[model samples]
Target chain A: MNAVEAVAKPAASKEKRRTFDVLEALIYLFAVMMLILIVYPIYFIVIASFSDPAAVAGGRMWVLPMGFTLDGYQELLKHSNIWIGYKNTILYTVIGTLISLAVNVSAAYALSRKDLAGRKAITLFFIFTMFFNGGLIPTFLTIRDFHLYDTFLVMVLPFSVAVFNIIVARTFFQSSIPGDLWEAAQLDGCGNLKYYVQIVLPLSKAVLSVLALWTAVGYWNSYFNALIYLKDQDLYPLQLILRNILITNQMQSSMGTGEAAVIAMRLANLMRYSVIIVSTLPIMCMYPFVQKYFNQGVMIGAVK
Target chain B: MSQSNAGMLHTLGRIRKNWGLYLLLLPAAVLLLLFAYIPMYGVLIAFKDYSPATGILESPWAGFNYFEKFFNSYQFDITIKNTLVISLYSIATFPIPIMLALMINQMRANRFKQVFQTVTYMPHFISTVVMVGLILILLSPGNGLLGNLFRLFGAEAPNLIGSAGMFSSLYVWTDVWQHAGWDSIIYIAALSAVDPSLYEAAKVDGASRWQRIRYIDMPMLLPTAITLLILRIGGLLGVGFEKVYLMQNNLNISSSEVIATYVYKIGLLSSQYSFSSAINLFNTVINFILLILVNQAAKKYSENSLW
Candidate 1:
């Protein structure tokens, strides 16, 4: 279509053309600049992570790493905190995601059923909580009441069943699974559980994968739960570990750090960038695998 | 009954008989009610000063004392103003990603567009603390990369995260750069739904690339845009405390001290739980108001809303 514009517009006008050429050129110029503006920080961080921590902080580094070294990675790896953080985060994401799927899928299946009694009320009860919360303090108190304070389970249990994921999954099931398929299974003496397990589960991986990825990323990035509930540093996830490093860095920098404190502070800053790369690397790799599910066509069974 | 069951039972009949779904949903329903709904009760402490020792049940009601305390504080108006101002500036620039998405959508399918999107989504994965740490490192005066670049151009390099003047702009624009590509996925998804037949027809009717986008693409995207807008407004007051808190240094606290962080400082750091609860209560109320207001606006304008 744009090709036709090039062919036809040339023969059409010479006077409406001068302003048009300049504007088109300018638009292209701005577009390129915007791309650079969006991407430069990520580039800057990656470059700095490989550079000499001191040199990077001093503003001598840019697109290329100056005095390139693996010192940051070495320092980061040596810290038990970093390792613990990684372990806790992985556990949280995996366990949290599994529970999330179980709850979301089962409840969604129940909600999708035409014969299920009180389905509307159940859906509303779930959706209503999303709209109004009793606020954070109340939520914290509830966590305390459950005796989940400073426990690893607190991190995963609170977000087990998200209404949004449930609704999306419910929609996927209701629309994609033909009633005839379930009828065929039931005629062969299969019950609801057996039919769902044998039929619905197999057909729902597309939307399920999307939900799983969403939950994993959410659990991986979660720090607030740790911040409020898990006060013990040993239970800290990667995000909380990184947050500690940042806080300590700020404190050292402010209190007029001695030589050792300066070393710690510099290493902390370097560790921050490297940890960003490390902690985020998992989910970044997961996106492409599930990218196919994030479309209306996929949910609408266009693929079949 | 025997005849009704023996004639032709189907999938619907099986579901009608089975109650095992209750077992499946039982764990999940219990967890949500315990964690999400139950905490809502603690919201009452906003009106009380019950210590952990006293416990919730025995704690006497303070009767609006905390609310009054929050209202009386000098930080009250400033925090509210700053929170709204930051969100306003952010909502103003929300179009950048949207426009970028439109541009990407306009291009014919190619690998370059895919590559551009992947690169843009990278920063969204970076944690808030690290993102701020990178910004501080990259913009630090004598040793930072961007700082040296500015120095090379013969201008004094500014400490971006440290400067009060640059705090809001830096925070919001950095957000745009990091998540712009990721967030644009919805808009791109919406764009894909526009019927190719409409574009083919528009071509026959003599519409240019820009014209087709201006008329069809923009209008087609309205519902998605408005739906997202309502959601965004619902979260207007609930800015990420971690990002803002990490970004804040003494120099920029004047601009970076938002309501969420203020509550954190008072509650967690200062140990004034009641006062912090009051501040948080205030933030939540204002957010509720904005959510309703924005949803109403979306419903009026586009006949779309979250509810």
Candidate 2:
């Protein structure tokens, strides 16, 4: 989309432009097909989320909500765990972003410095971990070892510094921060600490915001660690809770609809779509605001 | 001051100067060292009969034993074959994004185009579990919209989700539809960076829009495209696991059993930790070799590589 807007230079001679009429029509046809392919399923899911659970299962849903209802949302809301999940997700994303951004920026700044001791070694050390790591059992054991296995710390602490996020932050610091500023800071007896906190952090807002958003999203969407490490229901994030609901729905749907449990399970299955929407809605709302930065500021900031 | 004393003082002064920054970096450093690096050391379990009761220290030495077991496992050859082939299928479909970006680039900059682009990118963010659910709901043989549509056209509609032959193609194509637009963000950025002055010059020389794009946009995108291609190659084996896992049933597990799913079955479900670790270790080794080779190739070809 940005591609079309950015590269728009109106062509000469509408006739010449329309000369490849067959190909133009063909491309438009294919593009429309692709658009529908991408859009319709998700649109249907959203519609299904509001449809009467029984009607939807009877294969009656399409573009519009059938037997219109918000009962799925109501049912999902009644479960207090959903709110707990939302609270945990929000807390994790917000706090995790701050912790990660603080650590990543400073590490990136240190790694970006020309005169910093062992800068190359530090960068290499960080990058080395990206390509190889121990499998799940050992990592799970480590979480157990730290006694962080079921706590919220299991979700946030271990993944605080994503290597890619660090690299992007480091790249920005290297080019955007300007070596002359550092040199001048040193000359003015402004210590590295003051320069980083006072000057660098202030100047680094755009990329910092982008990294913060990425970290927040990572924390938001993460579930596998929660699945493995978390035993307690209270600690389950939105995704984990949603997965549980989905599995229960599957089991319910599989029992072939005669029993009272099956009827409730069918309601549970309808709630699956609603739960998905609920879990993703918070982050999606936050995304457009962060995404605007990615569209404009981050590109300029990214390239130094 | 004496030379050695001054050198020692310089080292200490440097450390003192950067102490605050070190303090800032300290938490992440400790986490990565403990969580990420320590696990690589724990890869030693592949060579031992590991027990959670005894821990890494007291685990009996097995020395090439798990790898031997994995190599001899009934599913070994098929898992490798399946993983590589599915990834190869993914690689083939990669250029669809380039084409989509180019097509979108050619469209007139209108509200319709913006809506179209937004629509395309939206699917990329739908959670994988939901995506598989959507696929299952939409493609069910007897009653799904598509299947029912096919029956109306006087044809027998097969159960797509149940078909092993359709699995990889369905996985790859669905991935393409979900991701192609979002992935085009960088290429779009690259396209925007193309010098419009070049297009103006081309127009003055009687060049067509197609010719101008062929000349300017394609060359501009090459660097970005090459960089992304290298990264994709580096990540060839590490396909996202959730969707495949969700999509699989007993009927289709034959083709759907890639290295990741196989590893999960072996480690998580079967508790063959050491053997699965060996398999994953092997996967990482292959990925490492590809990253280096592809990074070098990108550097050679386009002067754009991740390293």
Candidate with the greatest TM-score versus the true structure: 2
Worst-scoring 10-residue span by lDDT in model 1 chain A: A295-304
**How do the residues A113-190 of candidate 2 rate in per-residue lDDT, one tens digit apiece?**
777766777778898888888867667667787888889887777878787777787788877888999888889999
- Model 2 chain B, TM? 0.94
Model 1: runs farther than 4 Å from truth?
A: A1-31, A54-60, A254-273, A294-304, B1-18
lDDT of 1: 0.76
Write down the worst ten-residue block by lDDT for model 2 chain B. B140-149
Q: Each model's C-alpha lDDT? A: 0.76, 0.76
**iRMSD (1 decimal) for each model:** 3.5, 2.6
Off by over 4 Å in 2: A1-28, A53-60, A257-266, A297-304, B1-13, B142-157, B299-302
Using alpha carbons, what is the TM-score of model 2?
0.90
> For chain B alone, what TM-score does every candidate structure achieve against the true structure?
0.92, 0.94
Per-model TM-score on C-alpha atoms: 0.88, 0.90
